[model samples]
Target: MQSDLTNMQPPCGQIQRRTFLSDLGYGATGMALSMLLNREGSGQAASTSSGAATQGPHFTPRAKSVIWIFLSGGYSQMETFDPKPELNKYGGKTYADTVYPDPFQDPRYQERARSVVQVKREHDKIMPMQVGFRKQGESGIEITDWWPHLATCVDDISFVRSMYTTDNDHAAEFQIHHGRHKLDQKQPVIGSWLSYGLGSLNQNLPEYVFLGSYTDTRVKENFSPDYLGPKYMGVEFSLDPNNPLPFGARPQTVLEKEQANQYALINELNRISSVEYPHDEKLRARINSYELAFRMQRSVPEALNLDTETKETQRLYGIDENETSSYGKRLLAARRLAERGVRFTQVYLSGYGEWDSHQKLKENHTRSCKRVDKPVAGLLKDLKRRGMLDDTVVVFCTEFGRTPAVETRGSTKMPSGRDHHPHGFTIWFAGAGVKRGYVHGATDELGFHAVESPHYVTDIHATLYHLLGLDPTRLDIPGRKRLEIDRGKPILDILS
Candidate 1:
């Protein structure tokens, strides 16, 4: 008894924008439009208003895109990329007992590490390396035995062993991306700033994309665009090709042509409304999203479709195996997104706090490394062979490195795991603009602090911005004056 148009009718009231769209036989289109409007409602318009950089690049760019791989939970620097034979040599001894100076007594200890709860940490017992390490690749960089596959590609990577942060807790996760402690005023993350500065190479796809799921809702702040606006925030996507864009599919009742016509009519209506309210920035932004959403319905799914990939390529990403499959798919998807001109893609290779090994450190790190090592190596190898390495930068990092001493919580000095150590850690970069097979900076003998050329987290951001040919100092909003710490100096020594 009802026609297709009848089902879309509102229940006789003053029609809101959603209800008005629904009344016009908009189905999936209405859902997409409403969501886009709501998402843009909370913030300012994007710096890239019409598919162009509001402020163009400052100079020639070294990288066209970036793929940031984040490993949640802290990983041990000594056990991973930075090998410290001193740990094994000084095992079971306090700093005073060893030949090296006592890190606890060093003035830099209080200057660099900031405890959130104002509680002083005292872990005097040294925890020896849980895993053995050996020189790898042509560079002979010492890496833990756990990352055998990544070891093969060591010559292509540049390891920065002296990265440090101020936050000593899990909140360092956000600090790593935003370059600010949890106690300070939040700013846009690295990806958000990139999106704000560069806009999109592919207008149909989001300029900044985030792959993989997060166990904690608060982690969204790691990809947020606080003052720069919602348009710069990273858009979350699933690896599923059939439904990569949730709530973005057309209804069965709506034909493809009908949807197109509906979008056209909506665009016309919004433009007409703009004439009535010239100051309505949200309305103008909504008009822009309609065209993007319509184009994304096809582009996003195609970009995520793994079925088009060959079995050999699938195996390269370790998708053929179960242990590495989850992270493998996400990394592979990140590559696909990058190839399609996505400016920045953030891939969460681990769940929130997955690497937090407070006890049984050996068991946790061994299994955790197995889950990511091969796939990460595969990504590097794949990028190199495809010639994408020359224009894409890959970053592998975690929130912080584990403490060197055995955790002494509740007087359990013999606990197998290390505590969170924000005083120093290790992170690595590869491909495009960075020096190859190079190791920059260093931690102390016991890996207690970044003793040589220590870099705060924002320096990493500054480096990325510089690689993209943007000056971090010049990329700022008018009213919001940034602190000097927010605009860090680029690490020029590591640049090619």
Candidate 2:
């Protein structure tokens, strides 16, 4: 003031000394801050960002999506689709004296061994399927009495009774999802691989979706995207039967317009920041996710709204009944997801009480079957009727098959349960290019092993990819090399 800086305004051509210093300081500070923030954001982006997207298989795929129905805890082959007459004759006997040594000798195997409820020694006493088997459709493929509705669609299914695996315990369950046994070395799950191979067709919806009830808390190593990272992992919305996904709808207080404004503002800020830091892929992904989330809020609600479905369709899916309602809803939802171009949809059979019928085999298996059979049949029929069957592949599989012999360890003399048998099992395929109404491969007389045309879980995975027009052998990650087991061949005979 005394120097006339305020009054004179530093003359016409000259700037005030303090003013110049202040402007310079501000510019330096702004530049430094910008640089610091950019560095920090860049570092974060490098750590969190994913690699470039890859292309899918070469040929035009028959199936645009896959709906895998995972019957957890080993579904018994004898009791379900593959009825063994031998079990009926040799029920309640011992095969311990046979040449085959017990595979469950390690300390890690203690859980299954202790949990087993054996009715006889050696667990090879063939337990006849409590449910009757009848040939269905023109193909006359055999199915259980419990699954009358599913039987109607047998002509559209291709049964594989010769599937085999290495792991005999629950640990082996990993193979069902990842196509490998050793748990230490994590591999990309089938869904993850698919997601990685084929980016989402609908940007609003995730490529892979897991629909089920989370009543069973026993965490298995299977249901995750092992080495593929979080990007490829499937998103789980709701695991409750009453409400399958969480965070679907917003509160009434949060109006749609307000939500839109909030998202817009966030996205604008992200975009502005992204320009200052072009290498920030994480920021870009975050912006993309926000838009996707908003779209999902609208899309998912519409997809889940069963009110739009006719009453007859609702009844078909068993939405009216309590027992079948939960799974039925899931199956219906799966069909909807497939129709919407979601790539992979995995539906878990809900309710606790394992299919691992170590105590009451007949009672448990029958109840489980009742809960699943109708809804499953309804799903297949609905798909076929909607004309989605030709382009959608539906796979029905379990962790493994039960022991051919009765497990009589911790119970009364009369064997009541089956032990874990990963040696051989049955899985069914339908839709897409799969040959309809055909049975491929066979198990031994006692259903102990795959004596003819033994196929591994990887083969099934490869065949699925092949049907989807993906070459499983060619799917590669830049850093992590694949193993031979991962390079499985397509099950050609089953493919039409």
Q: Which numbered prediction scores highest in lDDT against the true structure?
A: 1
Query: TM-score of the candidate numbered 1?
Result: 0.93
User: Candidate 1, residues 1-496: lDDT per residue as tens digits?
Assistant: 6465424655577555545644663445554544444334435535334223454577999998999999999999999999999999989988889998888888888887787766556788899999999998788899999999989999999999999988888889999899888889988899988887787788778888889887689989888888877766788888876678876677768788988988888877876766655665555666666677778888989999987888988898899999999888999999999999999999989999989988888999999999999889999999999999999999999989988999878666558998889888999999899899999999999998899999999989999999999887767676666898887878888899
lDDT of each: 0.84, 0.70
lDDT of 1: 0.84
- The window of 10 residues in a row where model 2 has the poorest summed lDDT is 36-45
Tens digit of per-residue lDDT, candidate 2, span 7-112: 5566788885435533432332222222112212222113423333345655788788999888878888877878887666666544454334333342322322
Residue-level error in angstroms, candidate 1, position 263: 0.5
- Top TM-score prediction, candidate number: 1
Candidate 1 clashes between residue pairs 3 or more apart in a chain or in different chains? none
